[model samples]
Target: MTVVVTPLSGSEKLRLREVFASVQDSGSLLGYIRTYGFVRFHLRVAIGKCIDSRSVSKLESFIMENGLLDRVEGNANVHRWSEQTQLEKGDSIAAGHMSELSGYTRISVTQNNLQELKEIWDQWGNETKQLFYGNYGNLPYLLDVQIDERLFRALAQFWNPAYNCFNFGEVDLVPTIEEYTALLRCPRFQVDRIYSRAVNVPTFWKKLMAITGMSEQWITTRIKEKGECKCISWDALKGLILTHPDETKSVDVFTLSLYGLMVFPRALGYVDEATTDLFHRLSKRVTSVPAILAETFRSLGTCRKAGAGRFVGCAQLLLAWFYSHFRLIDKVVCRVFFEDYSLLKDIIVSTRRVNVPEENWIALLQNLQSKDVEWRAPWMIPGEILYRCGSFDWVPLLGIWGAIGYVPLLVLRQFGLRQFMLATHGLTQSEFAYRGADYKKRVGEISSAWNKTCRLKGVAIGPTTTLEYVEWRGRRVNDNIPEPDVEGARPMEEYLQVMP
Candidate 1:
């Protein structure tokens, strides 16, 4: 199916003509938009609704005439077409190998365990629950979320690791920091104070001691090293939640366990030491949104690259975020807009769509269009974007387990801003596991980068994109290697295919 482009209105065309006449250097228009803000409404007009094909062709021709397109920088002596041919060949071969593999593996997240955690939380005294609510803001509600593993498995197949988003035909969607922060709704979290990997890391027991106000000896006894990570089992934490003498200390321990098991579950039943380090920082008001987003992106990319693997990230929160965008239900009540109302709770309870077969889900997503997506969730009021880090060109995100780069510039439309074709030079190279020889060096670099983040204040206008950005996106889609066809297989055989 072909993408439908939206034609510009006569008024919009007139406005564009005026802007074009005012520009002293046509080539500098891109720079001008980058420096001083452009009114998003006056620019491309709307997202999903793009400039018509005729207008796009005319715009490109006009740009060429005005020498606005940047010249390619490379050795003129090189065989450029031959180089392109070689890259295409490599991509085709890799895609072929990937297609031969089985479908997406089921995620390993323990929903039953989360439900058990919720049952325990329900049994807590009103005072204990109030303490958690005051600080965490409806986080306990996430335990009640029922994750659709089949839906997530199908969603995983559409992840484009190179671009760091889910590429559903013409629609590109990703969970933004603003959306997650709102969903988390933790009153204690300071958005400006982000978490980063410290150069001198503390031991798991030391961090736990600080959080729980427990003796070092006690913490040391419970700490168990599991597969290169130091973790404390849920059973140990559950015991404290029920038996601890100090109410505040017990709540703190329960909250920490929630972060390990629900927010950033690296293991099945244990809270990893890395999670403890991040949790410790939270006491000082550091926001966990970026770290949460980083792990989600990292896990998705890992699963996509391998074609089949157990997703280790937080499945419930991811599914909640997904539902917020592709709303299957009707408009939630006006109460959802109130400060006291828990949107997460409503989503968890209201999301009762029947299980969709994996292949059907894949087909539905593959045919997704911009018109089909709710670009911004209903509960989200657009906020300033963390576009660049320090003097770094792109934003760098630090996760508990690793670091990866984010191109907020590419996703400007998510914040009701005009999207443009900003150069994504080193994004793919920025992802790295936290256990390399230069792990410390990499962590330090990302930490320093976060310290220098640049936030673009959000404008109150509709989302739109430039013609240049649309053209660039089209090129990316064209260049992408096609997945192998899944045709001619018998229905029974398709249904019986193993998820792994």
Candidate 2:
């Protein structure tokens, strides 16, 4: 069938010309609405950044030139390719793929109630099939890149089962002006690498407030509200922890993950004080990391079909939380927190019975051997994390949960030729990793890294090397690393040797 294009009618043409005139005259909706000079100027930067005159013209032209305004063809002609091709294509291609992706990424909800939710989560780390962000892309790209299970297990190499939401609150670095601006600036604001990093906050209070208001509105509305439980109720989640240590529903986990994504960044000073305090209080009430893992392990027998997405996603939160909250050992901290040193030691190293698979159990133990913090400093590389979790004597550096008023602890990881020589009677690349290069620059850079928002690298390497921990006075801190002893602590090689 041949389709005849309708020309813009006189009246329709006049109306469109008028709308276009207004759109260009103001350069924004707020402007087109005819706000006062003060308000217009305040929103000018935001308006310019957000408004796409070219796209708006395309939209207007589509309605007039295609007879969409008159509904000549109604919804039938709407889907056809035209000047606004991307709009229709996005509806089918982007939106359709997103929904399909959501289905694939959703946790296989085995049971509706908390009991089955708990079981599925316990049997696996999470109740869902969505283990990683990339899982959505997995099904579509399966022919090209086979999803690897070992890639998921890498985090196991660094998990400390002892440290979850139970006693931990997500601590994140404050976003620097540049990082904050990078997040806030409109996508069209092209940054010249040479001078872009220098983008500073507005000097005037009104301007700053306006910018912040825009940011808050933008951040708040970006994610759609599920209208379900915003977070696991403190009492309900806590009960699950005491009565059901090793299981959790994916919904609760995902809710808390979203909650953290919004709250923790603001806590780092991205938002108002009231907002920060409210989120901090909420953080205290949610489930702990250890508790989540416990429930996950307990349910492993049943949720065999579950995906790794939720587990990996939430677990990364803990890693980033641990690093962002890292504290150097101070005199007062050593005296007050470690006063009951023996009690602390027993809690971590005491022998206990666990029902997890041998390999997984050992991997969790290895994760505790070193905290694989999500954030990294400038001078740091993976190997330079000095050995704080010495196979024999070192204590695993546990994280301090802000909600519980726990103190962040750091410990010295000092080992020389004698220790290195005894370990293998040979030199290794690990020996000189932490040293060399400009130390001051490293400290500055690491400090700078901490000021950025949370970025988690959930991979675990079992050397108790902390990427960054420094005092406000700029002194390097050495708090004791949390090195708890698991019953079957042995070399990774030993575990592998007996594996196959």
Candidate 3:
């Protein structure tokens, strides 16, 4: 079972040159070598450090001049000889299963260089950690790397759920003018070291608007017209922003992440006037954090661009609406509007991507929670949110709706009229006795009215079932209100003006 191996010949130089020519980026470098038959690059220890332009050209000419190309032709030990040839060409020497160093003297300098490389790596690692950039590399390299999921999670936050966007992460941090100049001067290869820590950071929406110099209004009109509420992903917004001339400013990843958190949801039309007002107040509060303000503006600009003008107005119009409308807890509404956003930090921490990073799912859940909190903040949930937001003119109706716990219950009756009731207990099929007489009392009155109407209209009798009170918008009508025309729902202002 002995295996005989062929050796490489100098004739393979052409093939090696072709393979090297195919190497594009770092990833391609490995792939090319593996696919292109036992190809490898070797450099003299002294010349390796200086193998650029002049030196490489000199070696190429030297190889071609020698009959080295013919010497490698179909030899039994060619592979072994070729391996040795490759080693001899570089600082390291190798043949068959053995390898030796051609330049042992450079070991001290190499050790020193190794220390310097470690220092640079450490510096980049610290900086990346500070910016909360995610670890990115091939599986083998990154598998052993300690990936702080916290950092990955934070980086994921900048993604806008509506738009399927991603933050640029560490990739945006290109070499500065000074860094580039140093790279050009430094002989020891530093390119790999510099780019190793690079990850993509998201571009904020405002940054995009700034570059395009598109007015906030134009964006809003288009977005609304497109009917794409929250459809613009943060990544798309970033790309668009970079294409603009005026707005192409470099921003840190953390700042952009914060910006996304504050603005992306708003852009998606998840915000109400009160929520908008809250953001405005938050804007004033985080003035020291100008990136926050920048993010807010960009988000608004994106929404405007996305055609969410209604939302942009909602953010600014809430305060005015508060002044004009006399509601009981105007102060409370103001308080809830300005509620602390710190809770989002906890939610962010708890959020997880099942397998792949899912930005939108986490965002929707967060938006739902935030809205629920905003609605409940005013009343302390000592009562109900829907009941309070309704602000119905009739106190008894509010009491009735509130007592029902806002859950719709359906019940079939022996009588001809269908009966529906609000239940504290949300719909359940478990057999249970009806203890409270009040619900039946309420049910009786509704049945009587329904029966009276049916008799007057001469309608058929059957086992009437409750469709659920949540659907009962008619109870919302009273002395101050007429039967809804069903033509079209009136605008908020007209509807409000018709009431007290």
lDDT top scorer: 1
Per-residue lDDT of 182-209 in model 3, one digit per residue for the tens?
1112222222111110022122234324
Q: Give the runs in model 3 whose Cα sits over 4 Å from its true position.
A: 1-236, 239-387, 390-500
Ranking by TM-score: 1, 2, 3
Q: Write the per-residue lDDT of candidate 1 for residues 259-327, one digit (tens) a residue.
A: 889888777789999999998888788888889888989988886666666677777788877776664
Any idea what lDDT model 1 has? 0.66
Candidate 3 local lDDT, residue 69: 34
Off by over 4 Å in 1: 1-112, 329-336, 458-463, 477-500
- After superposing candidate 2, which stretches have Cα over 4 Å from the reference? 1-224, 228-402, 405-491, 494-500
The model with the greater TM-score, 1 or 2, is 1
Candidate 3 has a TM-score of 0.17
**Candidate 2 lDDT tens digits, 1-500:** 54344454443343333233222222334333443343334333323323234434433454445332222122122212111332322211121221111111122212112233333334544224334221111111111111223322332332211111111111212112122121122222222211101123222222322322324443343322223212222233223333533222233333232323322221211222222222232222321222222223222211222322333122222222222223210111111112112211221121222232445433433333222222332112111112112221111111111110000111112110000111111111111111247433433332243233221111122333332221210221111111334564554333333222
- The positional error of residue 307 in candidate 3, measured at the CA in angstroms, is 30
Worst 10 residues of 3 by lDDT: 104-113
